[model samples]
Structure formats: structure tokens, C-alpha cells
Target: MRMMLKAVVLWGALAVAAGFASIGAVHAADKAGSKIEVQKSKSPTTQKAKARPVSKASSSQRVAQKGKVASRVSKAKSTRVAKASPSAARVGGSKSSRPTQKGKNVAPAMAGGVDLWQGQEHLAVRSGSALVIAQDGGEALYEKNARIVVPIASITKVMTAMVVLDSMPNLQAPITITDEDVDYLKGSRSRLQVGSVITREMALLLALMSSENRAANALGRHYPGGLPAFIVAMNRKAASLGMSRTHFADPTGLTSNNVSTAHDLARMVAAAYRYPLIREFSTTPGATAEVKGRELEYRNTNQLVKSPTWEIGLSKTGYIQEAGKCLVMQARVADRPVVIVLLDSSGKQTRIGDANRIKRWMESASASGKATPA
Candidate 1:
């Protein structure tokens, strides 16, 4: 019986030990599950850290896009500024339009009704002084330094012709070119020899058409009171026409003292246009004068008078050391009668280029219906 009881105690001990082991295994399992849950919770933080580079890349892209947008906006503002500036308009909106060197004083003025074309397309004129006016209404289409007095060079021949025609001298009368007719100041060359004899009408034609300095001087010397009296008459005529800024020192225009403004010259051109002979003679393309039994060929000084594209009623060109490449004309451009005067052009072709530019600008304005009537 004692042996059976000991065996029972051993069996009881085994059961308790097995129960304790089961409790310990359950606690270990609970702790393992808690650790797994904690690991899962930390997984989101790890994912957020991995995603930082993507967020930074997105920020950089936004910054680059903003920079591009700002650059475009800045360019747009600059373009608007250029379009609004007058000096910029003169240069066709070029960055080099900023006034520099001799072009600094060439800013377009709004005087003399030029404001009529304000905000319209500006002309790119290379001449230092220029003027354009309508014949019908005497309205100024364009003006730059028009009132400023400057040397007119050989353009004085127009006034000389007018004075000679006013005297009603015999056109067929013989006028001999003498040594006194020679250009002393300018030493200019002429086809009319020292002893060459030509009719009064022929001399006038050569003087106006060919710009013969000797022929012009001869006409002055043969006047009623001599060359001095002829100069007085020129000044008197200028006063009558209200050319307040005009003065004539010589009839041949060889003297740089023969000065007149573009405004005064415009008036002189208009007056000359009224005379049928002045218009015919000045616009003659080419003529031959029988001088001393030799046929001497003479051509018009102004080339625009011969151009078929230009309906020039009158034209004259002048040049000297003081007066740089001057040209004046009354022509029909864009179907409007206009008087154009360009003076002090630096280049031989600059005056012609400025004329063509003015024509195109007027035509464009007319086509766009932006041009106003005079």
C-alpha cells in the first residue's frame, strides 16, 4: 500500500510540472505577438523615411517651373516697355535704338503737327533735318529740325532762277560766260568754258538742271545792278515769302554763307513750283545747250525727277562740305501730294534710303487706314 501511494505522488508532481510548462509557453507566445505588432507599427515610419527623396524631387521641380514662368513674365514686360517707348519705335524696337554718337540728337520731335501721327509708326530717317508737308492744306506730315538755320548749298539756284524769271529779261538774248563767272570760293568745275556763250534761257536751264555754278554766276553778273544787286533781290524775295531764316550770300550757292532752314526751303520750292518754266527746267531729265557751236550735254541733278515711279512736280539736290547731301522734292506718294525735304545726310545713299523708307511708311499707314488726311 505505501508503494502505491508514492507512485501516486510522483504522478501528481508530473501533472503540476506539465501545467507550469503550459502557462510559461502561453506567456512567451503573448510576448512574441506583442513584438510583431510593435514591428508592424514601426513599418509606416520606415516607409515615410524612404519617401523623403521623392518629396524633395517634387519641390525641386516646382521651383524650376516657377523660375521658367518668372523668366517668361520678365521678357513680356520688357517687350511691352520697348513698344511703349518713342526712341524704341524709331529703331523698329531694336535694343540698339538707344541714342548714341551723332544719333543722340536725332530724337523725333512732336512739333509742327507731327503729333498728328503720334502713336502711329515712326519713320526711320537718317537725315539730320527733314520735313514733309501736304501741298493741298499746307499741313506738316513730318518735321525734324525744320526751323533750324543751316547751309543750303546749291539749292540757292532755285531762288536764282526765280529772280531771273521775275526780271522778264530776254530769254533768247546771248549771255557770255566771262572769267568773273568762275567759282572763286569753291573752285567748282563746269562744262561752260570761260569764253563759252549761251542764250539766257539756256544758261538758266543749265544752272537749274545741271547745277552749273558758272552759268548761275553769269546770270547773277548779267543782272540789272550786278551780282551784289542780285543778292539783294534774293533777300528781298525771301522776305516777301516770309522766309525769316533765309539769307543769300551768292547766287551760285558756292558760298557756305548761303544758309536757309528746311522750312524756308520748303516755301522756296513751293514758290518755284508755281512758275511753269522753273518746274519744266528743273525737272528736265537731260538737255543739250549749243555753247560756242559745241553741243554740251547736261543732265538733271536730282535723279528722282526721272524715275517713272515718282510723279515729281519739282526736285533739287545740293551738297557741300557744310551741307551734307541735301534733297528736296514735291511728289505724289501714296496718292497724296507731299513735299519732302532731307538735309545733312551722312552717306551718299542715306537720303535716298530715307526717302524710300518714308514712302513705305506712308503707304503702310494708308493701307492700314491709320493715316489721317491733311
Candidate 2:
């Protein structure tokens, strides 16, 4: 797989020189988009990311088998990564250009308050953000702006969880941080600094629970075969997981180039829930733990963590100006498994509102289904 990824990188570079983006251009406007730790290739996680393409949905493949773009609106037309991204190369962009998935499921809006007043105000707000709901064999319920990739803030940790868990055989291994790990190319939020050594388990916890940028960087740099190899693995893992519509330019979401749509993230969340550790870490409301012999307390970012009604197994939240307030979760709605993704919300409350609306949508859908005859 590593050898195959190297070959693909070579091919992609050649393809790029020939006048097309091997991957979608990483936009320059969002600097905080590059901070997820589970993205670096050359390590075990990268290897996991490489195989992700194997499970791809044939109907949603935007790129041709020839590895070329088919249309401007669909398949992420061959836009130059350099031209499209004024944002300088981050961690994963230079690696394999593993195309992401396409074809998101979408739901239509019923008549507004005038129709029946399904308690819209109390259930959720009207933020108009894009949302995706997945349940029962990964079918989509509602989709908006599910295709226009944008910055994804700390939510990049979802990939971090996937890649790190799959690549590292020894989860208990300790990874040390360097000065470079904490420092940002642009500006990024971080409480950790150089010379801090923490176990892979702890690092994963810090990155997901506290949204620590330093923890994310250290994990990538410490990855075997170095940064380039780490990136290759992320792309590969994404491909194997059938997440062709998603791409990782950096380990951290601190770079503007880290873009994804709500539907793509839903695909990611569905996969992340498969991991027990990921499910626990993302949903834990608060953790009073020790790191590096120092007592450190951390809590889940999603405000709903304390709510008993969520019934969430996994959850994550993210934000960057370009990405807006973003969120995704695996939960039980209407007594069944369901995944939700909300992106580019107007404000903090919008994501919550989106969640409420989804719950209501599920209830309404279930009710409507019962009313109809087989």
C-alpha cells in the first residue's frame, strides 16, 4: 500500500504539471483549517487512510476511473491545487490525490408554519445551514451545501481518530511534542508546547476533547516515515472508507485548505462511530485527567454533552471563519441509529437548532411512514 501511494503521488504530480488539480484546491482564506493530527502519512494511520477508497459507492464517484474530472459542477473538476489554494501547501495536499465521494442524499422541506406548526421554534431554529442525516444503511435524509467543501476547524479530529486508530498497532505508545508542533504557520489555538511527551491515547484524547492543535501536530510529525508518508495514508484511508468527496491538506484544521461538506462529514462520522475509543472520547462530557504528570481537566466542546436526551455514541464540533460552526454526531433518534452533520452555520446556536430539527424530522418521518400503507 505504501508503494502504491508513492506511485500515485508521482502520477498525481505529473497530472498536476499537465494542467489540473490532482486534488481540489486548498483555499487560502482559511488558515485555521490545517490542524487535525490523524492526517500525517508515512505512519500506520496513513496506511489505513489509503485503503479507504476500496469501499467507495460506485454511484457517487465524481472522478472518472481514468483519474480525470468529468464535469465542472460535479466530480470536483481538475482545478489546480496551487491556483485554487492561495493557501500554501499544508501536510496532506502534496501526497496522493485520492478523490472523495459524491452524490449526497437530500430531503425536501415541507410547508412552513402555515402548514401545521410542528413546534419548529422550540425544536430548533431557522439558521439555514447545510445538514446531512444518515441512518439505516447510510441513507441520507437531508442535505444542503453538502458538496461545497469549506474549512472544517477542529472537526478534523474525526480523521485523526480514524487514521491514528488504524495505523498505530500500539495505541499506548507515547508521542513527544516539539516546538514546531505547537507553533502555527498562521494563527492556531493551542495550550500545549514543545517537549511535551504524551501517549498516543492521551494525545488523541487531548486533540478531540480539548481541540488541542499541538497534540495534533506532534502525532503527525512523530508518525513513521515522516509527514509526507503520513499524508499519503490519510488520502488512502479516505479512499478505502469511501470518503471520496473529502480531502485532508493538513493534520490540523488550522489551514483554510482543509475543506469538506456536511454530507461528506456524515460519511466520516458514520465510520468514526465504528471505533469504541472514538465514540467514548467524542461524547464524554468532561474528563478530569492527568497529562505529563500535571492535572489537566478537559470537556467535550459540544454543549449538548450534558443533555441526557442526545443518546450520542460519538460527537464532534468545529469552527473556522471559512468553515463556520460545524458539528457531526452518531446518536439514536426515534429508537434507531442516526448520524447528523451540520456545516457553515450562522452562529453557535445554529448547529444545535439543526440537531433539533433533525430529531423532529426523524419523528415526523417515522410517523408519516406509519400512516402510509405498505
Candidate 3:
């Protein structure tokens, strides 16, 4: 009986111990699963530290993100290069650059002026009033404030020359520069003193080539009906030529009242180009004449006449306080005859710069087949 009881107690203890061992194993497995869950929760923060959403993205999405970043970097580099370019600097840095005229088929502005274009190329013209016309076809090439009247300064000498030549006066006739010919109104200096004697032809040459105020005044005084009649003839000639906006108060162009528009000046320039004497005298680079037994040297006021590159047929320059600097020219540009008129330039070199710009623009246009000769 004792043996039987001992056997049963031992079996019961063994069964209880087996049950406790199984429970311990299950508890260890549960602790491991909890640790795995905690590590999984920390993985998202580590992923964010590496790359915000890319680290979790698929391979294809990552490639697309890299491409977007490269594109942005390339665009930034291109922007820097464009800002540093010389052409861009010129367009942005020049003080005289201005926007194109509204509703005009013009190009963007360049240094020192507005860019004007009728076709592919643009010209930078600095004058306040400017015009360019084809001499043969009368086609307008470029225009800026061309119709507004402004003081013409010494350009009046061109009209004075025309009037004198029309009368067919004796070229060899001796004309005396009297006190009346002295510029009392403007007090302008003159190489021709009172009591000096020069032929009518010499006076006209001086007036045209050198813009001599005294010579121009003497031409008017020696006209057929004196100064009053000369004035009348000037107005009549202007009226006859359809120069409705042109007016002349003096032969010397010293008077501020003497004014004309760029349009009218183009007509005057085209008309003046017809006279062989006007073309010769106006384009003469320099000349020397004898007055009162003294030798006086004179040079052309328009410097382009002396430039070897310019095929100038006729040229004139004028300046006064009220009129500003002015230039008129009949020249062959880009193998075509054209008339250019510039007025009211702010600086001495502005008109010349504008002329060169126009020449370059025309040549460029002709090369590109954008300009056709008339």
C-alpha cells in the first residue's frame, strides 16, 4: 500500500513541473515578439533621417526624384551663365536702353538708344528725332518722332545754297563782307571779317563746307532782292517743295525761330542731293581760301565725309543751344541709296554713333535677305 502511494505522488509532481516549463517557454517567446515590435516602430524615424520619403519609395520613384533634382541644378547653372554673358550685360547695363515703341514692329533696345526695325534687324538711334528713307523709292525705313518740328540750327545753310544756285548768279562776282553781314544777333565768331572780299562761289563753299555764318549771311544779303526778298524766296521754295512744316527766319540758322521737322529735312536733303554743286561743296573735307589778304583754312562740319568707309554723296551737320546737334546725309548703305536725318541729339558723338548703328543694321538686314534695294 505504501509503495503504491509514493508512486502516485511522484507522478503528480512530474506532471506539474512539465506544465510550469511549458509556461516559461511561452513567456520568453512573448517577450521576444514585443521587442520585435518596438524595433519595427523605430525603423520609420531612421528612414526619415536618411531621405524623407525616398528611402521608403520604390526604385522607380527614387529615380524620378533624382531626375527632378538634376533638372533644378541645371536650370540654376544656366541662369547664372546667362546673367554673366556679355550680350546680356550690355542689354541690361546701358543707361540709354529703352523699351520699344508701343504697337511698333521694333526690336529690343541696345546700348545708348532705342532699337528700330522694319524687318529682322534693329538699329540703335540716339537722336530725339530721326528718319531714314530710300532715296529712289521714297520708302520709309526708320522713323522716330519725325513729324515734330524742332530747331534746325545751321542746316538752314542747305536752303540758302539752293536759293543762291537757282538764280544762276555770276560765280566770279566779288562779294564784300560788310558790317551788316556780321552776326549781331547771335554774336557768333566768324573767320570772314568786315571788309573781306571773296567770290560768290568761295562764299557758298565756305557756307556749305564749314558752316560759316558770315558767309551764309552774305549770300542772303547779295541775293537779287536783298534780305527780305531772299526770305520770301526761301519760303516760296519750301512751299513749292511741299515742306509745309519748314520755316526759315535767318540764313545762318542761328535764330531759334528757324525750325523744321525731320520729315521736312528729309525732303530738303533729298532735294539738296540733286544739285551737283551742293554735293561737291558739302562733302569737301577741307579747303583754304584768301580773304583780305589772309589765308583761312576751313574743314567740313560733318566728319563722316572724311571717313573712307562711308560712301557719302552729300552730308551736313548743324548745332545750336535750342536745336541740339543735328546731321543729314545722302549715302549709299548696304548697296542702296538712302537719306538719313537726325536731330536734337543730346551729345556731340550721339548722332555719329547712331549713324554707324544704322549702317550696321542695314548691312545685317541686307545680308539676311530682309532688306531689298529700291
Candidate that would win on lDDT? 3
lDDT of 3 by residue, 31-144 (tens): 888898888997887777777555557776778889988899998886555443424324565534423353222223221132323332235577988888777534367777
* Candidate 1 per-residue C-alpha lDDT over 1-374 given as tens digits, one digit per residue, 9 for 90 to 100: 99999999999999999988988898898899889989899889889988998999999999999988999999888766655555454556353553322232233323233333443335677898888877643546676777788898889999999999999999999899999998777778888898998889999998888889998999999999999999999999999988999999999887889999988888888888899998898899999888778887889988778788788888888888899988888778888778888988889888888888888777776666656434
State, as a TM-score between 0 and 1, how close model 2 is to the true structure. 0.63
Model 2 agreement with the true structure over 1-374: per-residue lDDT tens digits:
99999999999888876544423344322332443333343456666667666545453453454344345434343344422331221223442332211322223222211111122222343433456454433334455556676778778888977887888547688788887776446677555556667788888887777777788777777677776776677778778777777778767787767777666677778888888998888877877656567777788888887787778888888877777788888888766676777777776688887787777766675565521111
Q: Which of the predicted structures, 2 or 3, would earn the higher TM-score when compared with the native?
A: 3
Number of clashes recorded per candidate: 0, 46, 0
Better model by TM-score: candidate 1 vs candidate 2 = 1
**Candidate closer to the true structure by lDDT (higher is better), 1 or 3:** 3
- For model 3, the stretches where C-alpha displacement exceeds 4 angstroms are 1-121
Total clashes for model 3: 0
Steric clash count of candidate 2:
46
